[model samples]
Target: MNSPVVRLRGLTRSFEQGGVRIDVLRGVDLDINRGEIVALLGPSGSGKSTLLQAVGLLEGGFGGNIAISGTDAETLDASGRTELRRNHMGFVYQFHHLLPDFNAIENVVLPQLVAGRARATAEDRAAELLTALGLAQRLDHRPSQLSGGEQQRVAVARALANRPELVLADEPTGNLDEATSDRVFAEFLSLVRGEGSAALVATHNERLAARMDRVVRLHEGRLQHQGKADA
Candidate 1:
């Protein structure tokens, strides 16, 4: 197998509420290889989002080691972490946080622009991604002008704009209706696989989890690998 796109060891996180200690994650050790899609299964309040935040480098106060694309996250300062995220990671949230001010193609293009990609090249790539996601006709529409599913599709296009090695998504389809969720998720999986990027997607849906390359569940602050594609 290729080198892992993401690796975590002894990863833990805790919070204090009302002078009481709350442990969200407990020594999570995982490896996600290139071109693999791993479903993170858990119920609400089970620390699924917490784990994704830790892996995405969006959380401080996390304990233990996190390596992305082979670079040790512990060694990086804030700016370095930002750079790492910019160049190597893509993120999708439950809500489609597309910029309401920008059109679909422009929303996708902005990230690449931030990463120093040329305007023309970024536009072309954005167009390609949005088109692939079945939004060719909606490219000129703003987020507010589109339907929920359309907005989410644009969000997917934006997440993939940078061509990152690893994609981290948290409840990406949770907001949509069942039919829309299924269709958008299928398109999302196809796009992620086509881009050759590894993904760690957190979701409460078992049917969706079973469709991934592997299924891992978070329970009682620990990770349990349920199985893989062939297993």
Candidate 2:
């Protein structure tokens, strides 16, 4: 296996409210290799999303070492963190956060634009990704006009637009029906694998988690690796 694309050592996350400290993650040690599809599963508030956010650089108040693609994240400043996130990480949430006014293609290209790519170049790459995701015909459709699956597919395409080293998906298919969710998961896995990017998806759905290469349960506060399975 290749060196870890993502590594978390002695990771801890805590939130203080009204002088009370709530621990969300307690010393989480995880390593995700390139091209691996790993799922985080557990009951509500099991620190699944917290772990994702921590590793994805969405949260930084915690203590520990987070290394992505061989760079120690703890040593980076705000701008450095932002740069790493923009250049090496991709994120997909349960809700497709597509802009209401932008069409599918435009939505997918937004990230590339944020990364300083030319509009024409970003659009071209976005179009290609949308085409591969079976959203070619929906290119002109806005978020409101597209179906749930199509919107999520567009989000997936957006996640891949930058060819990120790691993709963090938080209940990405939660809003879709079973069939649609399965299709979306298939497309997501295929896309990540094809691009040799690692993915850590947070999900409550056992069936969906089973489809991943490895199932990891975030129990209490740490990640416990369950065995692999064939979906």
Candidate 3:
């Protein structure tokens, strides 16, 4: 009965370049329980992004297990993997990656529409999330018209559009200034918590990571639990 939102075991990944193998992940095991947020701490090029990519099923060519909501990723074919990725999780990146042509609310509503939600229903959901993130007044603004923080806020809102069980954010605020970063991160935590979604957020900022429920560091392609966030 303790089924987690995400599970990884004995996960290993390596790349071959110039007839030499470079290992990125080495037998990593992790579980993200429902409604829990875990911070992944590591230096640049330390395989943090690679680790996220593995959990994300963004690509293949790895070994070991990845189970999302009890379904094994290895057992799923390409279409199945796409279905699983779309239905169960959402991803946020350092860059907003918003559609230049779409407005704030439209960006959020598009994903929901892809998931079979009705246009009106999706729009309502989008407005709710944007309002919660303090973007009620900017609903019609394009990404270019918005500030960096506001654009990231729209990205966050879009990531959460599906009410996914797992939200994967890779240094979501890394592109912002110190003050803007703090503000956006705070809003992100609040929105995710309010939605009752578990999150694996990758960030190098100890101060920001400490705000999560737990923290884990990556070293030598392995995961080391660093205890609870408050610890």
Candidate 4:
């Protein structure tokens, strides 16, 4: 059997605010298998988003170990961590952060272009991904021109553009309406699973969280196995 694509051991984080130390994550131990989708479910201030950032390498000041694809992030220097993040990780947020000036395909291809792929090659791959996501007709549309669901779909395509091993999403459908949110969530799950990539999503929607293979809840600065039952 294959090892987990992501592993966290004794993960802890704290922040200082107004001369007070606030413990966010106590000691989290987690394992995310490749091609699996896990939902981090919690209420306000439960440390769901914070844990996502720690695993995604977006924030430091965290003690303990985070291994991605078997690479120990705790031992890596700044540059090493940056390299690993850029090449192996992806992220999506509640809002679609698409550039207003760029078309759909261009926005999707931005990461590949940033990684130094030739513009033509990147554009070609972006077009292919957009088409696969049923966005071929909107390829030249700006974010404003597309519906909310459409824009989020483009964001999903962009996340997969780099063929990343892990994608971290924080409340990805939090801002959408109920029907549209469900549709967007389904698209995200399908896209990640279709590519055999692992995803960790932090969401408040119990119905959506229940559909995932596993559900983890963050409460009182610690994690618990709420399982699909809570959802």
**TM-score for each of the candidates:** 0.97, 0.94, 0.98, 0.95
Worst 10 residues of 4 by lDDT: 222-231
User: Which prediction has the highest TM-score against the true structure?
Assistant: 3
Q: For every candidate structure, what is the RMSD over all alpha carbons to the true structure, in angstroms? A: 1.4, 1.7, 0.9, 1.5
Query: How do all the candidates rank in terms of lDDT, highest first?
Result: 3, 1, 2, 4
For residue 90, model 1's alpha carbon misses the true position, in angstroms, by: 0.6
What does the lDDT come to for candidate 2?
0.89
Model 2 C-alpha lDDT per residue in residues 1-231, reported as the tens digit of each score: 456989999999898999998888999898898888888888998988888888888867889889998999988999999999999999999999889999999888889999999999999999999998998899999999989999999999999999999999999999999999999889988888988889999999888887788988888788787766333
Displacement of residue 87 (Cα, Å) in model 1 is 0.3
Q: Number of the top candidate by lDDT?
A: 3
Candidate 3 per-residue lDDT over residues 67-148, each given as its tens digit: 9989999899999998988998899999999999999999999999999999999999999999999999999999989999
Residue-pair clashes per candidate: 0, 0, 0, 0
Q: What is the Å distance of residue 205 in model 1 from its true position?
A: 0.2
TM-score of 4: 0.95
**CA lDDT of every candidate:** 0.93, 0.89, 0.94, 0.89
Sorted on TM-score, highest at the top, how do the candidates line up?
3, 1, 4, 2
**Which residue pairs overlap in candidate 3's backbone?**
none
Q: Which candidate would rank higher by lDDT, 1 or 4?
A: 1
